[model samples]
Target chain A: MFWRETYIVFRRQLRMALRNPAWVIIGLVQPILYLVLFGPLLEPIAGQLGAQNAYTLFVPGLLVQLGLFGALFAGFGLIAEWRAGVIEAERVTPASRTALLLGRILRDVLQLFVQGIVLIGLAFLFGLTGSILGMVFGLILTVLLGAACAAASNALALTTKSEDVMAPVLNSIALPVLLLSGILLPMTIGPQWLQVVSDFMPTKYIVNAIRELFTGDFFTITTMWGVIWTIVLFAAGLYVGTRTFRKENA
Target chain B: MIHARGLARTFAGRGRGKEKEEVKAVAGVDIDVEKGEIVGFLGPNGAGKTTTLRMLTTLLKPTAGTATVAGFDVATQSQEVRRSIGYVSQSGSTSPEARAGEEIMDHGMLYGISQKQAEARGRELFEQLDLDGLWTREPRAMSGGQRRRLDIAMGLVHDPTLVFLDEPTTGLDPQARANLWTHISDLRVRLGSTVFLTTHYLDEADALCDRILVIDHGSIVASDTPDALKRQISGDLVELVVTDAAQAGAAAELLARIADTGVDTDTTSVSARVRGAGHEIPGLIRALDAASIELESIEVRRPTLDDVFLTLTGRSLREDA
Candidate 1:
């Protein structure tokens, strides 16, 4: 019954997403621009970072960046859904409340996957090189990070319940994530204190894991921490988002 | 179809310090709705109409009450209650970007109906709700009235035995509201679905409801048929426009004799509520003529649900809403 309801809700969310897909591509634009305008600048410093080229290093970071920013602001849409009475409408039904949140999280993860593929496709044109398996692993990490962020974002949206509150809160969280996670530059190049602080950030571990995976390095401590953090974040997000949806359902 | 006793909900205190006091939104109200009865849950804003509706629909749990909607306990068997009833909230639930027909289909499926069955029922509802050629139309693109009709279609798509509508026509224009009323009335005639609707519109209660339940301050004030409730008020409202403003006081004295309510003299007008105004107006005109007082016009209006509310609550429903 739970899976059946999730599939029904998933189909509904997908249909709505497909109706005006311009937003999906629009969401990808920011990551693409960063890849195009900012990536070549990293090539000169690529040797210092111990990569074959800047594309390998920068592309993984951009994928992580996309995963974080792309999914982090999803609360805005959730707030719109809340105000539009979609949640209340669903609550009145016999549909599973957990299915509702899981279904939307699945939709968000699918969107993140597509955007990651698009970002990787453009990076290949910019002289990127990596083992196929490693790149796939890297993309998986990006998507996992996205699933976690999307779920957390939705939970935040349900809690705040208004765009005005959601906007500033997301903004405050977004700045630290974008700057501290080293999505643009490796934290190894930053101060020791900065690196220590970034260590506490979830995206920092996922970024480090994806960067290493792209270089065909998988069985390392960094990658292990990355997988663990990603799972923890996803679990935490699912827990909170489901709680919020269930509370609201009651 | 719906039975509730001492159905009450109390929200915990939100205010801080000395101001913190739990608010009883619905204070032990008993409600019994028969099958196929189009019952109007009439109340002004903040009168616990929506709160009671939510409790009955299982969206809200009552602090001190029991409600069995469609023969299922609201608290323990909520899923069963939800399956047996359709709820249309005041905001009109539909994703703005989703196609109208698909939205209905999805809602039906959520009720555990088959996709094929949902499609058949959805198309029929679209036709019934006057939403032809809007199968693929997005709700955001539809007009206000059309959106509301789509909401109704979604609710009925599951074909539940009971329907709960919370202020269904709150934001609709008169024509659209009246059009929706016909569709609502048709529900019981065609499908035998009992409707329990909440509304602040007195005319809607009179025109659409078989019975009206007036709620005030979290309690049921009165419950009866519209005509019966109106009869509780003393008489029809009568207003006399005297040609000479100076004769208003004299007219008031004469009008007071026939009035069951107090007569008011306002410049050239003397108005009061007169029982059986049809016979009394003729006598009133003759008395005015014998007194050599010229009259411009006399208006008589039958007692309405508003007057019923006024007599029951000591406050006009219109001003409160």
Candidate 2:
């Protein structure tokens, strides 16, 4: 029943999302722009500075940036539904709280996946080729990271019940995560203290996980730690999100 | 069937930054709704009608007492209670972007009905509510009345044994309201589902409810069938529309002198509460004549639910929130 409700809500959300062509167009185009513009512009600096790989570094940062943006927007749709009294209606039904949360997270995950695919395609176009297995692993990492961030953002949205708060909060939290995750540049290039701070951010692990996959460094301890952090973040996000929802209903 | 006793719910104001004071939304109250009965829970705004409905539907837990909906305790067995009832709130719940048929089917599936059964039930309800032609149209495109009908259809799709409708016709036009009552009546007759409804429309309750419970200040002030409650106000109400404010006051004074009747005066009208209108009408007209109060109009009507509420509570049923 949880899966069924999640799928139905996902379908409904997608349909509603499609009605606004601007969102769809922006989502499809923004990641491509990040890949094409940011990747090439940083390539010269990467080579001169002996950076690991420009496209490899750029892809994870773009993925986290896009994922955070997408997850942050997830709450607006829910708030709109709440204001419209649709959420109240669903509450009166036998729909489980778990199902409700699952549905919302699934919708965000699906959207993030679509955005990731567009970014991946653009990455290949920018001469960022990878082994099929590496590409698959990277995509998997991106999805888990995106779903976690989206779920966390959704929890904030449901609790606040204000889109104005959600938008600014999303930007404030996501911007720093994107900047400090070593997505645009290698963490080694940064000051030691800054790298330590980046280590505390989940985006750092996400970027590292995907970068390690692309570099065929899957056996490293960092990869194992990154996987553990991804699971921890996803679980924490789901827990906090669900708790916020229950609190709102109360 | 539904049973609630000493039900109470208090909501704390938003945010930890505020004080810890709580607003009592639903105070101690008891109610019993039998199977296959339509009970109208009547109250003015803020009288705790919606709050009580929320408790019975297991959406809000009672702070003090117990409520068992469909034989499942609301606090302990909420999921079972939820499974057994359908709730339609004052705010319409259907998604504006969803087609009417899709909304109904989606709710059916959510309530645990099989996909095939959900589709079949959705189609049947759509046709039953006269929504067969507009199944594909989104709610935003439908008329207000159509949207309300679709909401009702969605509530009924799961075929629950009990349904709670909160101010179901508040904004509906009279014709639409009538149409909804017709569907409600049919539901009772066909499926024998107990319907617990709250509304400010006394006439709607008079026409449709088997019993009416008038609540005030978080308490049930009166509960009885419409006829029995109305009869408690006296035989009939006679309104002597006088020529002016002074004349209406004079008329009231004259009528008050008569036996076994009470006269209440207002700005432009004087209403006399009398028993056995057949005998009182002659005496009332004589008193008006003696006071030289020219009666512009005279209306002798049976007591209505409004009168019963007015007499019992000393206020109108449509008091502002």
Q: Report fnat in order of the candidates.
A: 0.76, 0.56
Give a tens-digit lDDT track for model 2, residues B214-268. 8877888888997777667765777778877777767877666653466777777
TM-scores, in order shown? 0.93, 0.86
For candidate 2, give fnat to 2 decimals.
Answer: 0.56
The Cα error of candidate 1 at residue A61, in Å, is: 1.8
* Runs with alpha carbons beyond 4 Å of true place in candidate 1: A248-250, B16-19, B236-244, B250-258, B274-306, B316-321
Top of the candidates by TM-score: 1
**TM-scores of the candidates, chain A only:** 0.96, 0.92
Model 1 complex DockQ against the native: 0.72
State the lDDT of candidate 1 residue by residue for B107-155, as single tens digits.
Answer: 8898899999999999999998899999999899998889988988888
lDDT of 2 at B216: 77
Looking at model 2 chain A, report the run of 10 residues with the lowest lDDT sum: A46-55
